[model samples]
Target: MPCRKERDERRSYGGGNQAQQYYQQSQGAGGQKPPPQAPPPQNGAGMEGKFDDVKPKFNDVIFALLFLAQLGAFIAISVISLRALPASEGSVGLGQSGGTATTLNASTAWLLAIISGTALVLSILLLVLVRLFTKIILELCLLLAVAMSIGYAVYMWVERYWSGAIIFTIFAVISILAYPGMRRRIPFSKALLLFVIRVAKFHPSVYVIALIGTTLTAAYSAYWAISVVAIYQKWSPNAEGASTSGGTPSSGAVIGLMVFAVFNLYYTTQFLTNLFLTTEAGIFGAFYYGGRDAKKVAWGAFKRASTYSFGSIAFGSLLVALLDLLRAFFQILQSYESGQGDIIGAAVACVAQCCVGCIAWAVEYLNRYAYIEISLYGKAYIPAAKDTWNLLRDRGITALINDCLVGNIWTFGSYAVGGLSSLFAFVTVKASNPSYIQGNSGLVACITFYAFAIGFFICHSLGYAGLSSGVSTVFVALAHDPEVLAERDPQLFETIRRTYPHVLNPV
Candidate 1:
């Protein structure tokens, strides 16, 4: 009985061991591997694994060759433009009939040559620079080249030659093609190119708008030119005769004037369009802000923008009017010296007319500014009527009257300065050319040009000022108002608080 019991115990132990072995095999078959153990460290060696391998797909040499090829193309086009000039006139002799003669002095030719050369060198440099810096400088340079070429073409047209036209066309084509190359060098250029392309392709209406604006601008310029010419003819018949001494207005002078006129028209249209667009853009910006509960900010920005714009226009209009009076004075002097009595008297009359016109214009500008301010700030004062009643009654309206009176003094002072300046110019021209006032007509034209240019420049600068003020005001207002900030963008609010805390809390 003891032996049999021992055998049973042995059988049970063997069976238990067999069951454990089966369980291990089953675990392996079911993919239940043991947790991975780290590899053992090598004996005093840093690493045993292989280093990462990389393969070269492109050669640096090929890239260098491509860059050189592109640079060569740009340089070649620039060289062509620089060497070419407007064709020489077929007719010779000063003041002897036929086509207007072109007298290209050494200085003028040298300047043109230099411009062309610089454009070429810069274009090539820009190509390389673009590869490195990836900015729009190259594109801007190209645009400048195009503008220069256009100017050269106009010069040719005035000379009645085809050489300039042909050269301009060729350069224009090159610029267009090079634009794509420019895009490839810069990411933003590519994006801008795509945007313009998309606009051309999808929004043909934009072209129509541009065409309409251009047409209107041209018509306005034509009307202005005709009016000026008619006035000149009516005032100074002798000056007209002098202009025809060379059998036509000097082609160069005429071309120069036309170019000046065209540029003036373009700038004027651009100015008006910008003013309109700014207001629209501001309104849109404000509306967007208001939608986010930023109405006060928008209104503030609008007020500032309107004030600056109106102020600039008022100042420019006054300045131009003053300059015009000076110009008229010079014209009368020129006419008198040229032995043109009818023209002298006529020029004097025109000066008188201009003075009247300027006064009206000044009043209009002031009224416009006043209207805008009143509409924006709300009206609370009357001038003459209120003063008479207040003076008669001896009421406490004195402070209010004083404020209104003081507010307009500076504006009236500006008008007074303008008038005085005009008077000075008129007297100066009359004094200088007492014998032949007609001879000073040329001086008048020159002064007029200067005045127009100055006014435009001032107006342009003011537009920029307006834009900057508007942007700053909007950003500042956005920085404040925690609720608005939170609703618009919590992240942006935090960023503003972190980066520009002082801007938000200005002392």
Candidate 2:
């Protein structure tokens, strides 16, 4: 009913009043003013732009193709090899002689088969029964043994034929590809190629070592074969008074030696390959997971392993030397009783003991240190001091020592018993034949003591290395907590876990 301009004014005033009322209501609800209205979202142009820059850098298709090609090639080769081997050859075969023949001795084959089969079945059946610690221990031991054996073989091969293009090629390729950050400047493919070429150049040196190791191993194998034959000849009714015909070994003996040589070669080659691969893989894994900064950790682990192995060898050699010296002293005393031979036998015995001791100690030390370093750091070096030290202190040194004491009491105790038993045997043998005391008795006693020492060395070195490596590997695995340590030490976390349970759990 109002005039047109007055009506417009009234409408404006009414709109203002309505807005005021709404605001008042909102404030009354919680003493807060209404929030400002948000602007409508724009198109995701920023996200798209960022992705555009990244897309060209990665060729997912190429990566997938390469991975598939490698996998396929491996599968194809494995299948072809498996098929090529005759079923009989793959399995065990009876020799021409009445005695059974197998890839391993009959006893060994049966024992391994039974043990492996039982373990597999039990693992499935009693999956919940076995402790995690136990499983880890078993896996670790197996892994260490395998790795050591592989490393030894590879080292021997590399030492022999390292100068060759093929050897250098493999080594270089592995070093580049398996080591991370190394491929950033050079494409992975090119780096691998360069590595191969470098390794090839070292084949001559590698071949020399391999040749020497093979020859020595072959001689040892021959000795082992001859010893078996001698024992058989002594024990077998059919072999009575049967000396090696015309100074030529029997066909069976020759075959035995050949088998030993073949086994030694295969084991040595496989071990060396494993060692090289494992070292490279450890570094690669660490670098990949820990980014550019983990190179030191990888190198540390490698060096530590090398150091431990060398140390063990050195220690074993020293012990052997000491025993040899004692043998020499006894030999001299014996020669004096005989009044025939001079000091030559004593001197020879001392020199032989020293040489053997040195070799054994060196090998033992190397084996031990290698096992420890690998088990503790998952490589050789750990950058995170707290993490590394904690792991070593808690799991490696502490847990391993505890486990060793518990696990190896039997091993050490058995050796002690054996030594005492041997002493008793020597005394009994001497008592039975008082005549043995006249001239060569001292020499015989020295020989017996040396034999005991050798046996003890073998048992302890092999046993402890196997046990400690296995246990430490498991503890490292169990201690891995990605949420806690992964951001800083992801490589350590991942690799420490992947060392295969069999290596740790030797049981």
Candidate 3:
């Protein structure tokens, strides 16, 4: 491991500074080519030997059991919530007592039922339909659009979606298949997933780190929940007869605004906390797996994430929080009836959602690249973000990330896991506690489901962040330091060079 002084020296010559100087000298003012020289060793010549001495130090079998226990703890609350929901055949009207589940609308429900009934057969039909198309404009474009419309219609029926609100997420899976850049990412996505699982499987401590972040975020959330109640009480001191609006906005409206502010603060805090936590995981994975100062990776990640790069963490997190806040307000609008202003509300909804998408894309793009650079290179947030963008743009990796959809894949995949786990939770309660799920179970189920979902989401977010960040880090590291890439894993280096020649090889 590099000593403190040596580490400082490494930072002085690392990341954007080195990248700029190297690119300038090698590529000239035109900057038309990658540097011919292999990147110097990350922490000087003797560091690799020190890294070698730092063995993995994890007992696979023992750590596997420990990891299981850690993950089980995270899911236990979710399961208990599911088991407590009103799932009985006629538990005081399933619709009314089932809590706030995202059930299908009447038309959507019927459509989903029909499609779900033929799920096994639909695969074959869809595959045949896809194979039948031979023309680019006809098959991939026209025919695919028709097929996607059908699928989207089904989703809209059940999910209550607005058109064009989220082009990235709504048609994300299909987009990956249809778009050429994303289509190329099919293989890299698998490779990235495998690499992430290997990291989790071997270095079980990663789970502990994830759990810690999730726990702290939950704690702060609980504290905020309590604070919200106090805020509401102050707004309506005379709770029983406070419905009157005293020549101003109703107390509920004020409370809602306050709650939105609290939510923004909460989300900002959550991401910053998570950025540090998952950045720790990214750092550990990068060094331990990348064959660098493995033993000191944890400490190094902390000094870099918590100290030097805190500003980046805050700024990126704020963008994420802004999106969350906007989405929450949008949901509020959707809930309230729009009456004569329906057209105005619809227009506002479209604009609000567009803003949400822009912020979401920015945060996603920044964090995916910037966090990796921050961990590996120890650059400040803005500098890291800017330089990273230039690197990806110059290498055409920017287009790849957009079309490839790996980031969205991981995100939606995590949500799927959370949904399934929540479903299991609902089922468990319905099966085991038939009597409790009867009359007056609405509030109980609602509270239980809310807690369950919150816990499930936090746990899932923490667990998934490392994997997502790891994938980006691996690719960025591969591009930034080919020498380390080739030395650490020649097989992976060859795979990158072969699979993404546009990204790995200089023009």
Candidate 4:
């Protein structure tokens, strides 16, 4: 770790000045990369050696058991609901079927399959592009964000929407003015991204895991959709003529089943997402500390994530899942209140929705670092969360700025892929003229939305998650033991020091 004295000096100076002074100091009189030098080894096990010393044990066993029970319940519900799906002909549309299939049918199923396939391909391509052209891609994403703000401002002006125009104009100006400072961070960001890419490439299991995650999420999404459709077909009040059974439609039962399905959907997705992130974090942590074979490290990480630490992942995931479920519920309430012209009720619901969403975001952010701790140290969720919170508080500014910059790259990339997928969905539906989508602009819109969402989800899972895990693991590892990097890979440390001198100093 860099000396506390230097860190105090950095704190003494202001923002950009701190970075600037550190830059000059790093350059020295010769104005070149710092000479490679390893930090002195600490007592006890070396960072890499700890992996062998620590014996893995199951953490948060109760949460793991609960998660399994939930999974079992969801599976049972899905099976029962699916068995109740009405036999279908060509007819498929929303609302009352009146003796026809109203819920999703074979055509919708095919469409989902196609959309999933497209998303998978696009996500893989996105990873390839980021790896091959990290800097260029990053630059383009930044430029595009600024350009879109300017363009939107211009359009708003043309349409005589003064408020819209002014707001966008201000945003455009601020982004443009801030470009220089943002641009300066790109080199370091690019280096970090490239390192992560190289790590993923070195251990191909990372990609394999990503592939499995993408496929499972997409398939599960389809299954969830089918389950919802089946529930509506069998239990909805409007389904009287759609099914052969003459049982009266029970609205209460329908709502209960729907809620259960929705909750499980959120939980399952969150669980899988955290699982993959935890696995990747382990791989990156191993690479950072060195001394372990890449293959062994990767396999070991996956095993730990899927077994011993599974409950920790599940526990963290449950927090986010519950928040999301509440957010969704509030959103639905807001919509209902708005439709009923209950202005105050709608406003309250909207506010509640926003609050829940923000909380979910915060929890998810904490989970990112907590999972890193779990992956590296085999700690339970509470301990991992506590340590992660402490680390963030101590070194958050650097991590925040770095995350914001890199996040923009992936966010824009995912949006681009999603937009393309939506376009593909639109064109495909139009060309095929599916009975459900034909003549129904609403259905068309819904399908396109699903495509966009699935594309974004898949891209985030396969590309962003892997890379982001690498970045988070690096930060966590550095915070815990900077000496490890300095000892194992002095050259990389020097490169990091060149771009961000503050990194050398303890935060």
> What order do you get sorting by lDDT, best first?
4, 3, 1, 2
* CA-RMSD of model 3: 14.1
Please give, for residues 1-507, the per-residue lDDT of candidate 1 as tens digits: 225653343233222222222222222323333222211122211111111111111212332343335335433432332222222222221223344322221222232223222222322232233234323443444455445445545654674546536875675666567555544444322332232223223323323333333333333333334323322222232322222221333446444443333334333443333333233233323322232222223233233334434333323333333444455455555556557657666666667656766765554333332222222222211221232242223322222222221112112222222223333334444444332234445444343333233222222222222222222222322322222333334454444445444433311
The models' CA-based lDDT, in order, is 0.33, 0.33, 0.45, 0.70
Model 3 segments more than 4 A misplaced: 1-186, 197-203, 237-257, 281-293, 334-341, 399-409, 420-456, 505-507
- In terms of lDDT, which candidate is strongest? 4
- The C-alpha stretches of model 1 lying farther than 4 A from their native spots are 1-219, 239-278, 292-501
Best by TM-score: 4
Q: What's the lDDT for residue 381 in model 1?
A: 18
Model 4 lDDT tens row, 325-436: 9998999999899999999999999999999999998998889889988987788999899978877776453553454466667676676677678779877877766454
lDDT by residue for model 2 (368-417), tens:
33333332333322222234355454434333333332233223322443
Q: Which stretches of candidate 4 lie over 4 Å from their true place?
A: 1-41, 44-53, 93-103, 144-181, 240-249, 291-295, 397-404, 432-440, 488-492, 495-507
What overall lDDT, based on C-alpha atoms, would model 3 receive against the true structure? 0.45
| lDDT agreement of model 1 with the native | 0.33
The alpha-carbon lDDT assigned to residue 92 of candidate 2 equals: 30
The TM-scores of all predictions, comma-separated, are 0.27, 0.26, 0.56, 0.80
Worst 10 residues of 2 by lDDT: 50-59
